[model samples]
Target chain A: MNIIVCVKRIPKTAEADIFIEKDNKDIKKDNLVFALNDWDGYAVREAVLLKEKFEGEVIVLTVGPDESKEVLTRCLAMGADRAIRIEEPIPNDGRLIAETLAKVIQTGPFDLILTGVQAEDDGWGQVGVALAQILGIPHASIVTHIHIEGGKAKVRRELEGGLEELLEIKLPAVLTIQTGINEPKYVSLAAILEAEDKETKEMTLEEIGFSPREPLDATIDQVSFPPTGKRAEILKGTPDEVVGQLTEIIKRKKGS
Target chain B: MSDIFILVEHRQGKIRDITYEIFGLAESLANQQGTSFTAVLLGHDVKSFADDLSRRAPKVLVIEDENLEHFNSVLYQKTLSSLISKYQPSLLLMGHSAFGMDLAPSLSVEKDFPLVTDCIGLTFEEGKLKATRSIYGGKVNASVSLRESKGYIATLRPGIFPPKMHGEIKGRIVMEASPLEGGVDVKKFIEYIEAPITGEDITQAEILVSIGQGIGGPEHIPMFEELAIRLGGTISCSRPVVDRNWLPKERQVGISGKTVKPKIYLAIGISGAFQHVTAMQGSDTIIAINKDPRAPIFSVADYGIVDDFQNVIPILKEKISDMK
Candidate 1:
């Protein structure tokens, strides 16, 4: 049961100070830090666990320019048998990326494909499902647990209101894994050094027969800070006095 | 023929609230384009839900299939693609819920339609549709537009649109049958296991007093629980509390947890992350108490107190008791 996992490189959102560019069409990348997206870490771990248990190969793929190779190498250190990086300077468009991924994936007879439910940067959560559709296979999103038996993939999908749905799809399906499905393992410096000798492959858009004659299906027009919807009325006083004022407001509101 | 098609989403024979929210956007867009809108329901034996939905729109398109009694995206995509090819509505809408998130992206790709997900607002300026979506963990908003296409598909964030009632619009219902042969068999549904309601369902609560990692330790939970009870509310916490085994999974509030809309919410000690804020920001009133003045929670809060919740909770409880 060979598996292919898709990964992406994103800015370290929590540590970075994000600001919209003067053109309002992009973000300021001067001091921002980049790493493998947090959610994709879980995806890579899940794939490695499956390969370790089932005795099959795991291949990881990513789409970006030169810098994305860092994440691909990290996946190899973590236990993916091989890594593939599509060398292309693409916009942050989910559909366009999914198309390129589908073309590259056509080269393999993978039994399963996994991806983070959403990227931390754009948070589109669309690429995995769109790839499944382009390849004409079944897919599920927000999957928290997965078990394979007899060429079938049984998954637990997380739904709103604390509900879980148990589903089974045939082999060769796509699953967009949710966060916290498992605690991703930590990689040590020793493992990173060992990974330097592993196999890493690179492909171009033209190599994959992906030629775009038209514009992206959807693109960001402008970016800006979210409006401070309602400025909070800051209650400034000693704790006791402020408590008194809050109590009065609550009493009046409850009465009305 | 500019028409909007809102896919009616339901589970276990009960309609989801997002189905109504979609009507709000569809109505506004339809009015702007001088066209009609249809509420499309696809399930087994959905007559009652279709009837209830007819009062809200100009038309309801009902499609029934035994395979659709439960949601399998393969079946939904196949059925919806056929419907779109036959009708060719200018716009299609759905809720950005678990089901919608699973279905819309694949459908858009299969049909070569432009799609956008997790939208908060939509506008038509100069005859082009622009959608506003959140980025940078809800700290920024990006306006996006679709390239030239025949139609567009969008999934709206729940609780963002204001649902309106149209008592006078008695809509007509058009019925149809499944178009596929034996429903595509890419996947099969097994069962739905609802996480047991260990305590109150936080999503149903009117008032909620929620805590976060800053609650310091497990021993401090009882103090906040008492305050919540006194204030006629229930206690809830962020995902970390549940991960720490300090609280039950039922009490967690966030994207992976539960999306709740309460009348009054008090966020105590929670550093406002987008995952946490998107779940509770729909509350009618929000009050945040955190020692750090720069906590993101204060930005969306209606009232803020930059003080230790430990000192503030006790005094606020005493004051409420005295008022009673």
Candidate 2:
């Protein structure tokens, strides 16, 4: 089976700090740190799992500028056989990126394509499904488990109320993996060395037969931390006094 | 004026709540822009829900297909793209639920339109659609505006928009035959495994007592659970609790877990982080108990306690039990 996994680079949760731009009240950017998106890690892991079961080449693809290579290399080190980077900073527009990725994925005769349910940066979980739409393939999002047998693929997706729906699709389909689907494998020293020599194919918008359209003019005007609240008073007293104070606090705070 | 399109979601003949919420949002946007609101439903026997939807929007389009009874991206996109070609809506709205997650991106790619997901709010500004969404999980909020003349598509986060109220605005329902274009074929539904039932629906629980790494270990869970039971609420935890295998993934609340909107949310020993807060910030009231006064959770919390959860939870549980 030929499988492809899509990954993205995002600001790391712990390192990201959002600040409003002076000129725009609606725009904000993080100045601190960035890393591979959490769910995309699951996508890469699922692809690696598929390769382990089906014995096929896993191609990890990311659409972004130079900064995205970090995630592609991480995917390579994580066991993807090869990597492809779309050498352009796809704008905040989800549609443009989906179109570019759809075109790129169509070039390969892939049996299945996997992507994280959403990027942590924008939390737009729609990209994988949108790519599948453009590619004209069966697609499922938030997939927690999957198994490929014969020519059909069986997938379980998490839904509301702890309910899961199992779906079956033919080969050459798309699926967006949700987190907790599988544990991402750590990059071994040997694998990192092997990935350093692996060939990475770079595709330009022109080469992919698509022109960069004006980014969906979505501009972040400002970013601000939510307001803080009053400090909690720690009631320290005799056991009886503490109990009385605690009861008052709970009644006043929780209203129960 | 440009038309606004909304996708109606349903399963087993029952309409999803997000569907109504998306329609409510679309109705508001359409009324504000003085444009028509068109609802498109794709599924088997989905036409039955159109009558109910007509009360919310100006027009309804039902594209019936047995293949679409379940969410099939291939069929939905083919049908949606055909509809888009027929009626070029200026903006398309969908619920940012599991189905929307699967369908929105694919439709955007097929139609070559700008798409945004997990939007909490939307408004038109200076002839452009402006969307507000959280960045870095829920640590910060950002407002974004769509660029040019191309159509805009977005998926609204659930619970952001309130449910639409019933009214007397009757509309028309247009039944469109399935386009049935060539796309990926869905074989069948293999099986539907319901996640093992937990005690309560934490996502809908009005009160949630969430535990963090500060809870010591698995043995300490009963203390929080006792409080939850006494309060007639449910118990949840941060990613670390699930990561430690102390709680099942279903009991976890964060970016990777379920988004909830409880009336009262209590955090014990949990440091507020963007990933963890985004899933629970919609709660009506938030209370954080952590030893570190600098814990970020205090930022959005309505009440904060600078103390150890271990010492606090047992006493609180006892107090609640005594009150009962």
State which docking tier applies to candidate 1: medium
Report the lDDT tens digits of candidate 2 across residue range B147-247. 76558888887765788866688888889988984434474555557556555668877778899877778998887787888987899999767756778
Give the TM-score (vs. native) of candidate 1. Answer: 0.88
Weakest ten-residue segment in model 2 chain B by summed lDDT = B181-190
Task: Point to the candidate with the largest DockQ.
Answer: 1
lDDT of 2 by residue, A14-125 (tens): 3234555577553344465667888888788888888988898999898888877877888898888999998664454666677788888887789999988887766767
lDDT of 1 by residue, A1-256 (tens): 7999999998765434677789999788767888888778888999999988898899999999888888888988898888999866456489888988989998879899999999887888899999998998889898989999988889999887678899998879989988777767789888888887888888888888888646887889899877776678888899988787777766665555
DockQ, candidate 1, comes to 0.55
Task: For model 2 chain A, give the 10-residue run with minimal summed lDDT.
Answer: A12-21
Question: After superposition, which runs of candidate 1 have C-alpha atoms over 4 Å from their true positions?
Answer: A235-256, B199-209, B213-235, B240-247, B255-264, B268-285, B289-296, B305-324
Q: Candidate 2, what DockQ?
A: 0.43
